[model samples]
Target: MSALANAPFYVTTSGGYLLVLAIILPAVAVLAMLLVPPRHVARIAFAVMAAGLAVALVIVAELVGTGMALAYVVGGWQPPLGLALRADGLSAAMLAMTAVVICATGLFARFHQCLEPETQDGRAATTFWPLLMAIWSALNAIFVGEDLFTLYVALELLTFAAVPLVCLDGRAETIAAALRYLMFALLGSLLYLLGAALLYGVFGALDIHSLSRLDGGAPAVTVALGLMIAGLLAKAALFPLHLWLPPAHAGAPAAASAVLSALVIKAPVFLILRLVLDVAPSSAGPLAGQIFIGQILIGQILAVLGASSILFCSVMAFRQQRLKLMIAYSTVAQIGYLFIVFPLAAGTETLPAWGTIAWTGGALQLVSHALAKAAMFMAAGAVAEAFGHDRISDLGGFGRILPISALAFGLAGLSLMGLPPSGGFIAKCLLLTAAVTGGHPWLAATILAGGLLAGGYVFRIVDRALATPAVELVARRPIPRRLEAVALVLALAAVGVGFVPLQPFGFLQLGRPAVSAMVAP
Candidate 1:
């Protein structure tokens, strides 16, 4: 159920067509790949990617210019029967960011997947184009979908598309990793379905806005919310359930890793946030110290899980000997920062959660991590491609061979370590401020501790890059400068995000349910 479920549905708005184009254009490109020869697949894919990027930008501009969410109801029918697609400020922002990362990954992959002289028309290259488009389509669908069941369908599409990308190389280990990912995803899907069914059975509606009108203290509603969130946590790979992540992400090609880390996992998290704050009753007058679910305060629970994720996974990231594995682990650690927003953004008597500094910080963290992690993965991919390995110990003086790639890595690291003039710095600082003001000393300490640990791991790689190795490293093949530029651009975006005003972002608050509207009489 959505927080905006009860709001009036507008059939089509001024910029509504852009949302349709954003979704269908990539899907059309995927179809085009099937008809064209393998050689032209990359061209069509790139063209679609470019158009998709434009559409996403237009959607953002429309939201900003109009200062209202763009909405499209199918065939003049509203939800509970017809599906609706709506893009709020947060959705628009995610759409733009997804387009940028996907485009960058497409460019980087072209060089990374340079056709073999004998196998220039290989299936591997052709398959990647369709898969990429499918992922782009699925991600857009999830962001804009206005109903719970529709989101479930989008999640399934995302999973199916993402699994193939994981094992594109068809190696034994990668195949195993992909299977593991699929298994966990299937379990998550089932749990989510069961929860959705429960919600429909209890409330007679699966629309988020519709669900928000229900009595939050009901037993069925509480159980359904719990089941739904638990399922999403599994999909999000939060801490204890993250076993399938490192292998699947690290085993994928660098381009795939960027998508998986940057966008795929975040979708589940976004849904969880919606479920907690929007669909679940927030003004239910604390039922036995818990309003989120019958027995548990979802915000505090999520914050504790977030803190545990940060402390445990940061150590795991520090101990990884391989570069890609370390980056994958870091992704897990960074996601924890997002969950911490739960407690920090849980509004007091005077303010709304969506208007809180912690909410803005969390959103910034999500976008910045996507940019930084994508850059780091691409840079590491280039290094692995050049040196034939990614062992950190053996990477001594490796920076001399690929200075641009190393520079990209360093810039991304700065964001990860929360250094000034980088998005991570501003995001973490805001979260820290909220924690201190909220009187949550432990969470404040977690923020600092995570940043310090991040610096330690980042320093390990920087040290290796600058040191002299006994055996000089050599490139197995030449890497194009354009490939290097792709990574640098994303890293620069991560840094540039820091320039945003250091306060609660008004843009993100657009389309949020009005406080008066959220409370049941």
Candidate 2:
């Protein structure tokens, strides 16, 4: 029997099985599609995306309704020996975020997601759905896995699935980019796996809770934590470790680019958070590894990197001649926001410590960015589709030709820029307040600076699109009403999250650690 089975919410707690099903169902859908001839691949992929999205919605609704953690036991076995999946507030939030983005990406890909749209049956097109499904599955596995080894497997699965999505077009440059991604990802995986091995050897456990229960006495704990964090940082594409991301993400098909940019790098980040806050003992994390290296200290470092990424990449984003490359740089900048919570929430003296405010902020940032970025990328895809190129300057008067896409892009841009009544604005505001309360001036500065830089980049697009051009853009094909509407809805959703109150919310607190658990009075 599952540990959570006795909880009043177990009937709805299938969040765990729902997680696994979310991951595997798409893979199964892909396999079934493979059996069909080429012409049917797009139809099959769309059908699967439709159903997969519904499953995601069910899980989200249950999470919202129960206001509790959800779980599922694989093989009816519990943790340590039996694999399990669990979703807390943060995880459920992420799941819902991923579902929305993936759904948009699928619709956007229909414009040219296939390998050869004209060929009734072709290799690239058919391979697209399978790869997309694989990526989604890998993402779900990463989110809900309760054990270190399980999460590591999920990480690798995500990497493998994502690498192929980069090179779907079979171009030599894209192939090379994918290979670079594969290699760097492998190095990161090795580091993380090594740490997991060390921890298992020392504690005889891979479950996060069990590992947390171990006395922080072993040298193995320190070394393992270091290795694991370093690995996740690489995959997260943080600062110097981000060598592969720009090319790989930019070169992928637009639909793939949206997913890669919006979601793929996030799995490792979630794992890193788990390793620090869940596995590390409260008294074991310090700068030198003396106490539970409070996630806040590392959070500061993350904030600095985030700030630098925001400032530096915004400039890089501005310089990009290709629309997708610019958006890719914007992605790197947005990711910086996710890392700011560490320093802002590191106080060990308070119940819930500094975790709650920063955690909720980071989750909101992730969700908002996913929705906004996906919409923007899809809009960019629409631009490229209409004009046959993504050169920002050459995108003259695209707003006139593709009004809906331009409108969607602008709304998404509004959220990314942290404008009022948008999720991005609320997320940043919360992080800023947390920084101020926590006395983290550097994090506070980064948050403000990032918003400014984001505004600059967003305005650049809006300005260009709104310009009365010497010549106006014309669509290569009729822009579909359904696709346009979906993109618009997603952009609006990012704005909707802003409606959530600015205070530290109880919803975010629901399953978080109690006041006294991590923070000693």
Candidate 3:
């Protein structure tokens, strides 16, 4: 039987067209921007943003209403040959998160540009719209793409679109940072392509569903998986390979920083999750001992790296003086929590990885970090815009001048610091519980240490915000309340995620049953 026949859920669903619309809408906007005059670019982008967000929402609604995954087979050809697009509960969540962040970023960028009316149609403004739309298109594609090669294409588009955003201001340092980012990203792409080529040579297929159905214990499979995971780690900016992130994120415009930190880095992490869970062999049956050893090695290695990232980077963040740099370092620290989930969520004889508390905790951390980090970046942008600099020590009494921005930053920090009644708190709490239950005490301690370090860095800023300056801080330029409100809304969303029941989320398990069944004995 063909792979599609064997895997029944691979068939297209009634609402599958929405997945195409989610991806194509933003791409069409990019093409439309090319045809329109420079002054009309932002308008076209705005319309597309609204439509794209609607499509994302409709897709989420479709998944919830039908209670099944959405799938579309491109050109009516089954996988291992033709392409497929699928949106499970996870993909739908990513799509919605992407839409919300991208739309907020669009508004934040528009408002920031409007502050200088004469330059509204200038090079930066004109370039930002098309690139932003391209990024949105790329993110949507990454979330839904089922073929490994297709995902690589989306990653390339994401990297190319993001590089220019980093250097939008044309400053010497920003240009250098963009070049560094481009070099690292291209290197990652090359490694990923090499791995995909190796996999195709061995299995004669690069489709995830097809690969998942086959035995994966061959030597070539091991090498290919390792290369691909390493490549994704570079793209995700996990510690030790994160040299390119701080400068690039710190140099980008605030809106671009929000997208890069909050969304762009997530695509690779998502792919890595798919690869480890979907393509790796099950630790059961005849080869159970070998497979179990391999799984432990991989999971433990990732967990150790994650622990290092959380502790080391949190300290780095605490030491940084510039507001954006501190947040950039904190992004790396927050990402560590996701990696630690691998070991904690390792499936047992009966339970699947997706059904674990650690899995839910990791997903919540990803979504909450995206919202909270984006809000923090936007708030920092407003601070820099008002005071003309981002040196935290120099911004004493900034809260007295930009009270709304200060409040937004503090609220966002609540999530980052893993404080009560915040999404970060629940996520970390679940992770801690899993670590303790799973007998991983060191991981639990690392989580606690990371949270404490995050609190320290966050408190440093709050202190500056409340401090009394010898000469009261003054705005170099007036910032509108609307721009500040955008950040506040996202911060609230991050906190709102904490209200979800503290159990394994059923929504995340929507399309995972087939894969879980295949992996089980």
Candidate 4:
């Protein structure tokens, strides 16, 4: 029975079609948007968003019910010769989370677009809907792509879809920012492609599962891993490579900002995680232990970079005079916490990284931050729309004018600050526990310091929201209550993630190689 179960199956499952549907639905919507009359575009986009959300939710339900990763062997051909689309626990979670954020962002954008009827067929409005769908499709592809080559294609698709959103307003500065983003992204892509080529040449397979079974400690393999990881870090905007993120995110429209901050950057980070955890080899022999040690060393190096990002970017966030720029900087800072999980999740000789508490913490942080940051961006957008400018100093008592938006911003800030009864708090606490237990005191210190710095920046916004301005500020136009509600709902979801059991998440471990199974005889 064990052998039978282990045998390769070239057939598709009942749920396999869902994966195809998830990727193609948005692409179809993009095509429809181009063909349909301009006036009907928003309606079609919303319809697609609703359908996409349902598909994502169904995928999650199917995974939870079956307790297995969903895989579709395209055209009944398996790896090495054909592409496969697979979603493990992490991918499914990210899929659902991405769908939720994209749906909310679409709703927000719809209202904003409607506010200016003249711009319905304008470049920003018509272009945004299709691009949004394109982004959704590319993100889905990245999550499900089982082959390195397929992922490279998905990354390119994502970049093309996202770069234009940055300059949707078509301003000179924004266009310049978009160009900077494109150039850096292309450079990262080239590096990643080179690394992929190296791996393919060495292993004769581009599939992750196949690569995982190979002897992974070869110098060539190490070099390829280094190149791939560095390229992904640049795309993820981690620390020193984060130069393109702030301007691109801040200058984009609010909906675009939410999508970029909440989703786009995560693709490369997800790839990094996959490369480190799935493709790397671990076994019981002395040589295997050395391989494990090398991987751990890499994890430690990443943790240090994560710490620096938290410290440096948090200070930058606190210093920003504009609300959107401050939030953009905060994104870079919050992303650090995700990387800090490297050392914590780098389990000892007796354990697997997937089984570590830090793994769950990291996943939770990713999902919670996506929700919270999306909410925060939308709220900040609302504030900017009402007041005409996002200058923090000039927007005193603006919360009184936009009470719901203020509430949304505060709720999102709760997660960012890692306050109690919030998902960010739970995630940080788990990571902190792992750090202390692992005897990594510096990592523990970094966690606390990051939280403190987050508090400072969050307080800056909250203080301005409540304070009375010396010169009263008037809203140029009133923000719709429903728009503020969308942000608040997302923020509440971020807080709600705290309620999950604090133990190592069993769901995230599902479909991953078992620690016991991997043990050598």
Candidate 5:
């Protein structure tokens, strides 16, 4: 690694202000929404989305142009005392993915609301704009925040914003689901905060850059990381801690479900990645013996949990009769792939974890899942909107009625099922290859089994779409082509990811050398 990669301090780059714009633009729009008339809220939201997307693109461009992480020290103050925002290649990918999904979701929600013009300026419609923008702001903040405490605050904002979205329809069941989500999420927040406090007390700093430079053998460090990972697992809805997800995701309106499933849960997962890779001590120096054992233990435990989630929730998804609930369960199943990366990407003395093929596979899975799952939810929403319900058995001949939605659903399923010409296939292949080469046959088996299970669940819906019912299915209301088109575009994007080379992507590795240098030395 170069000297620049070994630098522990952050330097404010020329384009660092773009990160601030990314976080604040949606927030400013959120405040603007509160002062505007109900009729103008959506307009403001649309404008913000456009600008936010542009900012995210610019951030990505600057990152590629400079070939370094963009960093901005707040108020010209350094970390361990003040705050900083940084965006690497991974962060830029996340920002761009978020912008695309949020934009697609906004269009979907706007069209869905237009189905009932009387409700266009109604409470639910108006309330959605501010909450959506708030989520955008929180997600952006989480992506760039350089400290653990800042991430915790961003998580709180995300939780508070996301909970209400679950109950936006104001149904008793939806409200109950929202409350369940809130309770579990709050418990997660408490655990995460406790861990952050412990870290700060031990090292006198909470910034990732500062902590990555410290020794990792202290008992407090281990316990703090354990607590934080456990807390993040709950928030991520990884299996066993995942009881709140299905109902909360399935019960929410389609746009809300898309955002929650595709974007919100990912924040905690991102933090976990940082914790394991950047903050965890490398297995070197005098304490190498102790730290190596600890790292392996954590990786194995998480891999087992991930395998269990993939097998168990996939089975549950196959059994669900409701369209949204099945997709919701699939979300949990898909999340397993990310956790399994911990073990698959375990570093050697010479190569860092992020340099492995498994790391690229995991990143691909995250981005592809975000795009594919959002399209699936939007397609399901369109189905429910066209018909009065989403019961798969009764949805026979649906393809004949809403061909666009049916096509979108099927295309998204291609990714979930790990089929060819889709991002999911390439991701799973990389992961499977890593598992085999890394001498983890069981994980390789689990990867194959998970793909099979995913196919079973996906084909159920596809079969229904191709079925000939005794009574022909009919649309309860006409769905706009534009609404369906948004989902198709997202699904296509998911598919487009397959075109990338099947290797550790250079783009994803752009800003990782610094962290790798710190962790592996």
Candidate 6:
């Protein structure tokens, strides 16, 4: 049977058309926005975000209702010839995250323009709407693509859609940042394509499901895996190769910054996870063992980098003159948390495989970060809008000036700090437990240190935001309730994640690969 025919799901059994709509609506919206006048941009973008979000929600509802993945075949052809899109639990989670972040960004940007056109045509606004739509479509595609070739196309589309968003304002610096982002991402893409080519050459097939089922591995496989992972790490901005991140992310407008930081960088990371867990060979044979060792070794290095980033970046954030810069650095620290899961849960399959706590924690971190970071960035954008600047020290107080925005910022900070009843806290707690149980002292230490640093940095902004503006900081445009409320909802969602059962969620394992072949010891 074709892979599409075997897909698992939750709601209605429909999968193909919904996936098509999820990808199409965004592209169509982008085109429509491009054709509309600037003044009509916000309305058009809002309508698109609403519709896109609805599509995303339906995908989850369907997935949950059927308790299986939904699948759609392109051109009515099966895999190995035609392409298929499958939304498994992981993809559904990612899809939901993308929808939330994109929707929030649209709402936040409704109050401002990146660079409105000079004419009545509103060309810039029109242009941005479509680009945003294009980006949403690309992200969804990346999450759902079942074939390596299909995924490669999705990654490229994501890159093309995203790079332009960085320079939407058309300023010289923003343009420079966008170019740097573009060049680095292209390099990453080259590496990924090289690996994909090698895979096709070896297996004569580029479908992940097919490859994993075939259990292919060897010198060529290792080499291809290395190239692909290296490429994705650079794309995801894992330290050392992360030279392009802060500038590109921090330089973008607030709404844009939120989406870029909270969502875009994650695409490559998601790909890496798929390669390692689903594609890479997992055995104790010299070659297979070597690959696992490499992953664990790299995971440890990443944990250290994450710890240092939290410490150093938090201090740097504290010293920042601009609020946006501080948040940008915080993005670095948050990225670190994603890596910690590597060392903690990525060992040999010994002693029940460190249980499922670590696995669940990592997924939690990814999702929660999406919600908290998106909300925080939107909140920060509101602060800048109200005060005309993000000067941390000078903006003595914003709580009095924009209560709702400040509150949203504070709530988001709570999650980032890993406080109780917040998803960040639940995520960290699970990771820490896993580290201790796995007997990884360093990983445990790093988790604690990261949390502490996060606390220090998050405090710096809240202090200023609540300080009661020295002279009653007046609102620039009366603190848009709609925008602030959007941020608030996101923050609440992050906190609610903490309420999810602490144990490993079966939903995450709906279609899990058999660990029998991969287990160590």
- Greater TM-score among 5 and 6 belongs to 5
Model 4 residue pairs with clashes? none
Number of clashing residue pairs, candidate 3: 0
Determine the backbone clash count of candidate 2.
16
Local error of candidate 1 at residue 371 (angstroms) = 0.3
Off by over 4 Å in 6: 1-13, 36-41, 113-121, 215-217, 282-288, 347-355, 468-472, 514-521
Error of 2 at 371 (Å): 0.6
For candidate 3, list the clashing residue pairs, or say none.
none
Which tens-of-lDDT digit does each residue in 1-521 have in candidate 1? 44344566556897888888888898899899999989999999889998999999989888878888998877877766777888988888889989999999998888777724455458876798899999999999989888899999999999999999999989999999999999989999888999999888876767775665555436766777788888888889898888999999999989999999999999999998888776775325445245644423777788888899899999999999999999999999999999999889886444667879998999999999999999999999999988889999999998898888889999999999899889999999999999999899999999999999999999999889888989988888888888888999999999999988653298887777666754534
lDDT tens string, model 2, 1-521?
A: 12233342222254556777787787787788768877777787878788778887887677778877777777776556777677776777777788778877777666554323564356776687778887888888887778899888889989988999999889999999999999989999999999999988886668765665555444677678878988888888877677788899888877788899889988888887777777765324332355544444455566777778777887788788888888888888888777766656564555453356777788788888888888888788777766778888887677887888889888988788888888888888888888888777877877787788778877788888888998666677776766677678888888888887644366555556576755432
TM-score head-to-head 3 vs 4, winner: 3
Ranking by TM-score: 3, 5, 4, 1, 2, 6
Error of 6 at 57 (Å): 1.5
lDDT of 6 by residue, 251-332 (tens): 8878788888888988888887787666763323456556666666656666776666666676666677887888887777
Q: How accurate is candidate 1 locally (lDDT)?
A: 0.86
Candidate 6 worst ten-residue window by lDDT: 1-10
Cα deviation of 285, candidate 6, in Å: 7.9
Better of 2 and 5 by TM-score: 5
Of the candidates shown, which would achieve the greatest lDDT relative to the real structure? 5
Candidate 3 ranges beyond 4 A from true positions: 1-9, 282-286, 514-516, 519-521
Residue 228 lDDT, candidate 4, scale 0-100: 90
Tell me the tens digit of each residue's lDDT in model 5 across 1-521.
Answer: 12224554788899999999999999999999989889999999999999999999999989889998899999988777889999988899999999999999999999999999999999999999999999999999999999999999999999999999999999999999999999999999999999999998887888887786666446788889899999999999999999999999999999999999999999999999999888885224467778777877888888999999999999999999999999999999999999999999998766778779999999999999999999999999999999989998899988888888889999899998889889998999999999999999999999999999999999899899988999988898899999999999999999988887553387788777644454443
User: Model 4: per-residue lDDT, tens digit, 323-406?
Assistant: 999999999999999999998898654688888889999999999999999999999999999989999989999988999989
Q: What are the per-model C-alpha RMSD values against the true structure?
A: 2.3, 3.6, 1.6, 2.2, 2.2, 3.6
The parts of candidate 5 lying over 4 Å away from their true place are 1-8, 282-285, 502-504, 514-521
Candidates 1 and 2 compared: the better one by lDDT is: 1
